[model samples]
Target: MTNHPHASSDAANALAALAAAPAAELEHILSEVCSSPAWAAAVAAARPWSDRQALLAANRAAMAGLTVADLNDAMAGHARIGKPKAGDATSEREQAGIQGVDTALLDELHEANAAYEAKFGHVFLICATGRTAATMLAALRERFPHDAATEAEIVRGELRKINDIRLGRLLGDTA
Candidate 1:
């Protein structure tokens, strides 16, 4: 993937566009990546990224700085795993594994989602991009036993994975 000749230039162009965008516009764009205003603001303030790597590093740093409240803010933006938010292509695409799942499995997934949320006080989150419905459900159940602090760290890690994928898309880096 690093062998691609135009990758660097493309990333530089994307970074430049982000850097030059108006504050509101940049924040709005970033909100789709991670809903926490503080995260968006931190990344936005560190504009004029030198390269794709720099932007990615900034994203990691900003994510590490997120408070529990900020994590909640980011989590609020995601829909439940099986129930993708209307018009949210990202959620729909990521949760594609749940599509056409058996009725019994769907019902079980719904019930598990409710229970997970009840226990964790947030939606069941996973990097559903390439995972099956059963896989996500199993993860939800597995994580259910974890304490709040542990779960929060897991959520942060998942959120970082999601952020990296989204930012790659934003930069048109399919590879």
Candidate 2:
């Protein structure tokens, strides 16, 4: 990705550039933020955000309105909770807590992930930033009983949290 002049700028300035960027460029940037094409397009079209908070609010709203198909599309971008691969530094860092656990724990996580995928028909999605591998496994197990509709809603919420974190990073807001 070419560093657009505003990519490293402050939140307000970056968002201002995002609003005015060419459609393809804006879509590319927003896709990195969230995988759902509809979500990205909606957010890009609703640009000119007043501040970081407004951008986050729009993200929340866009995510909240996602359909099950959109949610599934977005979830496809995530690695299974404890099994992040070498690619995608953002995912690796978000799931850093799971990086160096015992083999037994990693095996258990793999098994739980398989089970979760079997039950939900999608990878277990969560805001794994700051969460332990055990916690992620527990969450997968806990959510296993939810019906498909319920699980989809939970996934949407998790996706929203992820989008917020990624958006903050995009805008160079450490907090």
Candidate 3:
């Protein structure tokens, strides 16, 4: 990111490059990098990264404080169920991640998602990494009965957890 040998310049440039992106581009990048409320600020403040590890670490740290709204926005960038892209096949993780949802589970999740939206006026959000179809389906069923405020917070937490695992793999960096 930086031309000079100094770590400061590169870190600064990486962060600046991210910050200067147009709002939509920034949002897409943030969603691609990690979906969390703290995404914008963390990516925005990624200056002075010592390396890829530090950049990802800062992202994790910032995501620790993400609000529900942030998680939802990040999810908006994802391909919805029954709408898989060929590129999703490019990432084995995505394959494994998506494979966790079986047809039956997908059907139930769809119904649950619609019900969740009807009840809460938002998407039925989750961080689907490493989750099995039954487990995800159960989770959707379990969470479906919750009231709006409680469910909103739960979805946010799930998004954060999912984001952490995603970034950890993406950059080979852990928080």
Candidate 4:
């Protein structure tokens, strides 16, 4: 994949550091990207990636093998769409669309979030990078009727998108 024109020297430095980091340390860093320990360890085991694309491919493969339990572990790290974790820049940035919106919209979104969790038995997850609050609520409502199997598959896809975006931020790829 072509690199972002704004890819900084910091990304290069970070990649080099990641390549040379101890296994435990590397996995720790990766766990922040996607909180599945298996995913982190698997990707870490494939270290010294030749480039961003290689690293991404490794992540994809690891993600493809995740069990339901692994997905649950990863989902634990995410906040609800309208309620980003306080003091977390990453969550704040990803859920920025919820900011400055109508309070009624936010309240309705929170109510919908509770209903979603009650029906699905997990937090509603989405790649909320640039989506508006209303948009997220609509999507959540749309997906609310999916059967368990379909929802699980959709969750995996959303996790993949979130992981890739976080990885892109980590490596300055703008992917």
Cα lDDT of all candidates, in order? 0.88, 0.85, 0.60, 0.88
- Backbone clash pairs for candidate 1 read none
Off by over 4 Å in 1: 1-7
Q: What would the per-residue lDDT of candidate 2 be over residues 1-175, giving only the tens digit for each residue?
A: 1355665455566777777889999899999888899899778867778877888888988998888888888998888877786788888999998978988998999998998898888999999989999898888889989999888888889999999989888777553
Model 3, which residues run further than 4 Å from truth? 1-29, 35-38, 49-57, 64-68, 81-86, 89-92, 95-103, 173-175
In order of lDDT, best first, we have: 4, 1, 2, 3
Point out the worst 10-residue segment of candidate 1 by lDDT: 1-10
Which RMSD values do the candidates have, in order? Answer: 1.8, 4.1, 6.5, 2.4
Write candidate 1's Cα lDDT for 72-117 as tens digits. 9999989898898878888888888998999899898899999888
**C-alpha TM-score for every candidate:** 0.93, 0.91, 0.62, 0.91
Over 4 Å off, model 4: 1-10, 173-175
* Residue 87 accuracy (lDDT) in model 2: 81
Clashing pairs in 2: none
User: Once model 4 is optimally superposed onto the true structure by TM-score, how far is the C-alpha of residue 76 displaced, in angstroms?
Assistant: 0.2
TM-score of 2: 0.91
Candidate 2: where is the Cα deviation over 4 Å? 1-9
- In model 3, the worst 10-residue window by lDDT is 166-175
Best by TM-score: 1
